[model samples]
Target: MTSIDRKAAADVIDFLHRHFPRGWKDWGRDRSVSCTMARKLLIALGHATRAERGAEPLDPPSSPGSLPRMDDTLLALLLVAERDYGFGQGAHRWIRRMKIRNDPLHRDLAASPDVFAFFMELGAVEDGAWTEPAIPALLRYHAALDPLPDFDAVPGLHAFRTNAINEIPEDVAAEMSDILEEERPSLWQLGMMDLLARRWRYPEGWLAASATGPHLLRIPQDALASWMAVELIRTSRAA
Candidate 1:
């Protein structure tokens, strides 16, 4: 449970998503299925080497594939959260029980395609995998964040005002600066996407947003200058 083998995790997900797109289980009553991908993935995660997955009543393994060695934690979590063939309810209970429910780790893991794929399988595993669906909301909140604009990309304050004087209100620049300084968190705000990925980690309004979305600071379109100013301020403060 210390560290998961990423390659092994991906191998497991690819197998299920391909073959058993409907459901995943170590052992089950569905005799119609003669193959399971358990053994290869388990072995990859440093679990015991077993016979190939077959129509066994208990602990079936998967068809032959080269799986790397890894920790069994993620795989075990999936088993606990799988649909009809496994624990069909919430993963939160298991996640909390296992002490793996930290927001920081979940947010970070969601950025990885493999780990995100694993968690995304949550309620939908037995009914079949997620499609007609984008990444789940929980995972999306944790997905790889958008990259920030380059410092050189946003216009300098002087250059901004000279060409776009009429674009914003007379006093908007000072107002934006006050908002940025007042609203900026003393912690991960400047650090993580201007502060919307908290996922119950922070109180509402702690993160800012506009009509465009939470991803952007709450500046309106008419005030793009304010957005530019916000970025410049963030850069200077960072330096």
Candidate 2:
């Protein structure tokens, strides 16, 4: 690959690393890393495409309806990565392997170390501020990434922060509420109330408007507390 190609791939990889969770692959069966790898690859692809087209890098694609096209995102990512970044035939094969491993509706199948390295090389080229090649060839080197699955699909967890907010339709949101009520009441309620509060910007009075008889459920309370703790830990680490 040329100097430019390596730089672009490196930039893309760095972006993925920034978004990828720490010890991502080590989490529960290593599914976290796997899931993240796949999803982040999509994001990286979108970024590359936007870069090639001379448009702003798309952090996330926004839509007023359902989720954005993940498959298309992946395809675009691969094509652009290969074309502009010079990822090469070997890298392409590796990506194909990862894609085939992806369960889509079932499990997470994220990027491998080799893939990340390829992107990292491209990123370096994209930046042009650096003049050294950290990795000389893709023929001998490969990256080792882990699995980060869709936690929401996990049996016991229902609460999560997603990119699906801000454009959720009311009807779907209500249905989500009903599903949560049946399976995970407290979480469902928490999610619904949170969404409502955001949308309507209601006052503190809304918090006191619970219709389920003035008492809090233990599981829901714990979930809320856990979420808060996670945020605090993450914030502390960032700081």
Candidate 3:
């Protein structure tokens, strides 16, 4: 980490604190929160990029040796931030996706824009080959934030999207695949159902969304599909 990276990281931390939900209050120390911690890593990376360019730093110091180690939480934050900042007018849409927060980690802080953007960029290779599962939508989301590095320049970006997600177009598949991988994994099924409630305009309450209704032995598939539909709408518009 460099001074700029540290500063940017700090800025992101501040951003998370500012944007973290108050009405839906959760967590202990802000630092203990998974999303905030994840954003911190990203802001740190942004600061590093700014420093490498000899630009004035943001705030805190991001020295190279001080770079935070990347983890799945951090990676998920990166993906989110990338989608938010990378897209043009779609920042709010992408940003909203991360509003669900990391309840399992339930530390305190949650992700912000800067952290998510950096992760998206890091997920890709120089040649535009995505190191992760999908590429097209990732690049689109990343490029959406800012065309700075011009992710569009990466070769065969569409190809990467197509191959990764079946018959769907490359970009669409990539975006869907990444979201499914991150947002709706089996490990997070219950959480996903809760997330679906948020997506579907249900009032808050975790069990309210997941529990069975009259004559229902389990949560209805249609209800689940509705949640997925809303998410799809968000991603599609952003992509």
Query: Which 10 residues in a row give candidate 2 its minimum summed lDDT?
Result: 213-222
Candidate RMSDs in order: 19.4, 18.0, 18.0
| Residue pairs that clash (backbone atoms under 3 angstroms), model 1 | 36-62, 37-62, 38-62, 39-61, 44-69, 53-61, 209-218
Provide the lDDT at 225 for model 1: 27
Question: Relative to the true structure, how large is the alpha-carbon lDDT of every model?
Answer: 0.32, 0.32, 0.33
Tens-place lDDT digits, model 3, residues 168-208:
44444444445556643453344444443232221111223
Count of clashes, each model? 7, 42, 28
If both were scored by lDDT, which would come out higher, candidate 2 or candidate 3? 3
Best by lDDT: 3
Candidate 1 lDDT tens digits, 1-239: 02233554555555444434543354322323122224333343333343354322223434333333121223233332332323222234333211222331122221123334454443222222332222222221211123332323433534533343234333444443454565545532343333222211111112222312211211111122223345545654565
- The Cα error of candidate 3 at residue 189, in Å, is 17
Error of 2 at 238 (Å): 30
How well is each residue in 1-239 modelled by candidate 2, as lDDT tens digits?
Answer: 11123334345445444433442232112233233333334333333222232233344543222222222222323333332223322334434422212122232223344554443354422222212232111111122232333335543333323223333455645654464555643454466544432331101111223322201111211222333334423432354
Backbone collision tally, model 1:
7
Model 1: residues with Cα > 4 Å off, grouped in runs: 1-127, 142-176, 183-239
